[model samples]
Target: MSRHSQVRESSQLQRRLESLNTARELAEGVLPEQELQSVYDVLERAASRRSLSAEHTVVGFFGATGSGKSSLFNAVSGSELATAAARRPTTSAPLAGIWGEDGSGPLLDWLDVKERHTLPPVPGLADEHTGLVLLDLPDFDSTRVENREIVQRMVGMVDVLVWVLDPQKYADAAVHNDFLRPMASHGAVTLVVLNQVDKLSSADASAVMQSLEGILARDGLGQVRVLSASALTGDGVQTLRGAIRNVVVQREATTQRLAADVTRAATELARASGEGEARGIKGNAKARLASELSTAANVPVVVDAVQRSFKRESAKRTGWPVTRWLLRFRPDPLRRLNLGRDDTRPELSRTSLPPAGAPERARTDAAVRDFADDASTGAPGPWRAAIRGVARDGREQLPDALDQAIAGTDLKATKRPLWWVLFNTLQWLALLLAVGGLGWLGVLAVLGYFQMPVPEVPRTEGWPWPTLMVVGGVVLGIVLAISGRMLGGWAARVRASGAAKRLKAAVAAVAEQRIVEPVEVEITRLKAFNAALKAARSG
Candidate 1:
């Protein structure tokens, strides 16, 4: 690969790695635990492997028993590194072969390949295969569990995988279904080889290769390169070396392998994350919930108390002063409910409202659930469940908080109307008139008893001045008192209606702060998470 190509590949790989990390973060609570752990494991292994040697290409040879994998490894490196004995599972542990000197110590250590050998640079192939690190991993189908585990670990760490198979076992289900089919995305860094092809005729060899190609194509590996080679006779050894040399020259197998891993992880995450962005709670849904919560909080009861309280206060302020005192004998409705402002009252005073009965409480609970369900409509199962939890949280605080809210509200009950003053003044003037007339009458009676001289008594159309003053004062006072009563009733109703409006508004505010906002917060978080996950998958 050219210098420019290397730079572009590096930049692309960096972007992919970043996306993988973002996907992992977004999928933390959403995806299955093990699936994300697998992604993290890949990233950690890739980082460690790259830190050791970006120049070297680690190619692993994986096959079942009797697949001639060790023979192929020896032929490629031109060294007898792994034991190619005719046994069930000859290779117990992985063997490493390095070309062009400085050993990939850290890389091999990370791969846990203890058997290491340094190969002399191939005569004509020295420059092309300079940084090759060939690994002959243990048989994946080995009877020993430990051997199979070693193969599995090495397979993930290697930059490229060369799956070697004999003519008989090339179509084996274990090799195809277990490994090759699943790793189809790594086609860029994968190669398949049919070993010991020298034993068959040209026609038979062609037929077997064609069959293998068909099987690989069905396994979602249609683009993967398959080659015929005989490790024993060195028939196609040069051709296999040429293929590996091309990969070694590029120095991009590590990044390609890691990129493929990231793609695989992101795909699984996308499946679990579901589709589309989160739609937050709707406005009408919130209003409906608030209405239900108002009912649950006994807002109606408080509003009714406000109206009655307003009426009681209005009567005291606007009625006839003499009899207005009688209105105070009946307890103010709001004061009895332990609501409204009292300067002498303690700050922590709770409203004396009754607890919600079963029917009302059930309606409130159902409304909260229904709101959550509606808000989370079409959301994934996990988000819906989360929304429901958000709605139910802090429910125990509702009753107490509501009572406090009602108590804290200003009912405007202390204000007296100006009309009361005018009526009281009129009554006072009438009383004074009656008192003067009575005193005048007493004076006349006294003068008559002693036979003293008296001034002529004033009269209006034959009615005595004292009698008219006394009777007129009493009759006018009575009419004014009746008018005050009628006016007070009308004013009380108006004030009560206004108070009810204010009280209902206060209740709506409480519902928003306590219930609606929390659910919306979850919706916002879900939206952010979905956006991040989308970028991760696309990148």
Candidate 2:
């Protein structure tokens, strides 16, 4: 390849590698572990192979059991590098044939090839194929399981694949379905050689080549070159040599192979992540969730307590001084609920409110599920499941969080109303007047009984001053007490309504922290994954 082309390839590879890393992180808890690990393995293998030498082009000769790949390996190298036979599974392990001065030791070592051979320079082909490293891999259809495994492992590491097929098995289902079809996108680094074409007449050879080409095209490998050659007769070997030499000279086989692998991986990951974009949760859905959580947290109960507490305090302020102290005998409603007090960390404090019953718990669970479902609408199945999982991740912590929110809320209940203070002062004055009038009457009665001289009492508007003071003070106090009770009821309602609003807001915050936040995080992850995949696939 030209220098500019090589640089472009390197840049694309870097971008693909970065994309793979991002996909790995995003798929951690969402996708199946095995699926993600497979992609990770692909990336690691590609990175390790590239870390070796970039000069040598490692091409493997792969075929089914009687395809004569070992013969073709020898023909390509122009030397007897591997034993060739018509029998099945002749090659057990991979045999490498190097054709350059540079020792591909590290590359072969990474490829795990133990048997090696060096080919002498061909008359006119030595310089062109200098950096080529050819391998005769074991039969992919080997009866021995280990031999088949060796082929499978080497398939991913090789820079290029050259499939050698005999006329009889060129169209074999296993070869086409298992290998050719899957590696379709790797056409730039793939070739197919029809070995043993010498066994057929010229017309038959052409017909067989034509039929194989059709099959390969259906396998999505239409761009892959199909050549007819014979290792035994050395016929058409020159053409195959030219193909391998061009690949070696260009030095793009490795790049194309890695790029194809990345494309396949990215495609698979995108499928697992879903195709649609995340629109996020709807506003009404969040409000409904908050309302449901409030019910479950007993916010209404706390609000009721606040109202009752206000009324009790109001009664103390406006009642007759003689009986105002009686209001204190009863406990404040909000205090009993462990609310209406200042607390630095309400999350740590347990509310005295009643434990949620079965109905409340069920409602909360259903609402959470509904919220996840609504948020995940139009998402893929796996992402929807992940969204639901996120919502429930901190479910056990929710009850405590909600209770803390209620307890930590400032209900404004502690501040007494100014009107209450004014009414209270009047009540105290009235009580004092009644007591003074009684004292005066008692003194006058005692003097009269003792036959001592008694002073005449003052009168106001033709009424005895002491008698008027006693009757008026008593009547005024009774009337004031009755009026205070009516006003206290109205004031209690206003305070309760305000408290309900504040408490609901606190409950909404709790819902956000415990449920909505987690769901949003998953949605964000999905968006990131989608963008990464897009970058990976971008032209």
Candidate 3:
């Protein structure tokens, strides 16, 4: 593919992966803690540097019980470095064949092994191949399950795999399913050798090679090179040596494997970020959830408890136009700061979003915990903290969302802003001042026209129109300012409240799906992988 095509394919894959990851995260947040934690644990390890050799690659020998893996290792290194026998299950422990007399410094460091059963360098191997560090791993389907794990780990880390299958186990199910077939992605790194092919007649050996080639093709390893070799007779051993030299020495395989691994890790990290940016809800999803929950709780009609309280407090704040200005001064549910201060309290005099019963409240609390887990459980970064951020402004937001939705749906409201109060006050002051000024102007004109001394009008006792006028005019001017300020704050407050609700609702909905679905998906994937492995083993 062209570079552009490759980039586009990558981007497309990234999007699909992100959606899957998002579902997973949301699942964690809404699912039971133990299940969610399991997801987190896997994710954390998946992108991490589990194997020491980020650069050094694994080379493994995998076959049935009697495969001469250890003898081959000894033959390759010119030393009795590994134990090979019919009853022993060949090379119980992984053995390394370092290329240089200089020792496998970076190679071992990359593998992260503190020590190895060391082998002397093959004479021309080190000087010929710079980075080659070959290995003989335990059989993949050995009686020892730990050996299987060892080989499995090696497959993830290793650059090249040299399959050493004897004629009897060459078509073995254990070797195919447990060792070979599942590694479809690593076909380019695989080499198939029929060990002990010399035991058969020449025609039979050719037939076996052809049969193995067909099997490889069927296993999605169409391009894998099939070589016939007899460790007993030294047949085609030099060809195998040349192939290993091409990779282990030149260090070509590690880069390709690393590139693939790194790309997968990057993809997972991007998934942790989710698809593009989350423009949370234009309104709160949680409010939908909360409203649903409140209905479930029988909060509105069943008990008439919270809804009544909400109505009473709402009425009080909205009652008399004269005293309503005091409502402006009381507090904004969405505003953390007062008119000039930042004092915040979540306790509702009327409507509160706190979880109520042990069951319903449990669900609410569970939702918060679940959303938190969801936000966080993705790989390679501070996910829990991100989840926590989602919950930070949650309480204040849900109630506001409920309020706004209730307003838009059930009631019509030109809800006043603080600026509206100021504007009205200013306009009232302007009118009062205009009245007082007019009265004074009347007194001035009367004195000037009659040529008589104007009597000094005493200040009014009860209703101070002059003071009222000044106050009213100022209040009116403040009201005028309200228009300018309303657009942004209204938009912000409405969104903030709406988002709080939407987050609660969407998280709840998304979490609802996560309860058993994630486990189901993983189980299915694992089963498919195992089935392929078993078929390979039977080969």
Candidate 4:
């Protein structure tokens, strides 16, 4: 590869790593940790391996028991570095055969390979095999728990995997199902060799290879390279060496392996998160939730108080002066509930409104559940659960928040209307005129009683002025009081409607802050997480 190509490839790898990190961060609370543990381990292993060496490619030979991996290891390295023992689990620990001396030591140490062999450089093959560090790993199917553990750790840490299979156990389900199927996304850095092919004839060997390839294709590893080799007769050993050499010379195995790891991890996350994007809260759902919350907060009760209070105060201001005092004995509805306009710190003082009953609470909960369901429709199960969880948690704080919202709202019930002032002034003037007329009549009667010459009372249009004042003022004030009562009813309805709107709006705000917003936040997080997984999976 050219220098520019190398730089671009490195940049792509870095971007993939960054995208994976983004997905991991977003998936923390949304996904179960047990489902994401493998991805976490892959990321940690990638970081540790990348920090060590970029030039060396670590390829491990993994297989079941009696797979002749050690024999193949020795044949490829041209030295008896690994013992081809007849025991069940010959390679208890990992053995590293380093073809290059420059940067293999630290990489080997990172791999925790204590038994390392430095191979002598061959004249024509030195350039082809340089920087190759091959590991002979323990059998994955070993009876010893520690041996299986080592294999598992080394499988994730290696840059390339070469599965060696004997003709006898080449079709084993344990290896194919547990190992090969899971590593399907790592086809670029994977190779499967049917080792010990010397035991079969030429035609049988071809048949075995074909059968193994068929099994691999079914395991989602159709693109992986398959080879047949024999360590005993040295058949196809050079071909195997050439394949490993090509990977080393290109120096892209480490990048390819890490990229494959990221792809696999992203695929797992996508599966858990499910498909599709979050459609935000529906308009009808929000409306319904607000309505339900208003009911639960007793907004209607407050609105009724406002209407009755307005009428009572109107009667005090506009009633006939003779009977207006009677209305004062009746208590103001809103004042009785401690929700009157006189309250300056309503939020600090609880209103006398009744607590929400069971039916109100159930309706509120059902409304919240419906809202969350609508917002999370078509989302994955886990994402849906997460959104509902947020909504449920916020529901616990709703009652207090709704009360505070109701108390804080400016209902405008206590404000005096301009018409009331005009009517009040007119009533006082009528009362004074009637009182003056009565006093004049009393003076005339007293003069008649003293047997003096009574003065002729002033008259206008054939009627005494005092008589007209007395009867006309009383009749006009009574008419005005009756008109005021009718108008106050209309104004009371208008004020009640306005107060209902304001109170409902306050309740809606409480619902939004306590429930809707939290659910939306979870939905947004799930969408971002899914997007990040898509980017991580992309080339």
Which candidate achieves the best TM-score against the true structure?
4
Checking candidate 2 for backbone clashes, the offending pairs are: 1-250
Off by over 4 Å in 3: 1-58, 83-89, 101-129, 262-348, 351-539
- What lDDT score belongs to each candidate, Candidate 1 first? 0.77, 0.84, 0.51, 0.86
Clashing pairs in 1: none
lDDT of 2 by residue, 414-520 (tens): 78888888888888778778888888998999999999999999998888777877888888888888888889899899988998888889988888888999999
lDDT pick, better of 3 and 4 = 4
Better of 1 and 2 by TM-score: 2
RMSD score of candidate 2 (Å): 2.6
- Candidate 1, residues 244-354, lDDT tens digits: the string is 988888788887888777766666666666665546678888778767777777767766766676666655654445566887778877777876666745347777878
Per-residue lDDT for 174 in model 1?
93
TM-scores, in order shown?
0.85, 0.93, 0.47, 0.96
Q: Local error of candidate 4 at 295, Å?
A: 2.3
Clashes of each: 0, 1, 63, 0
> In lDDT terms, how accurate is model 1?
0.77
What lDDT does candidate 3 reach at residue 39?
37
Using lDDT as the measure, the top candidate is 4
Where does model 4 exceed 4 Å of error?
84-89, 122-129
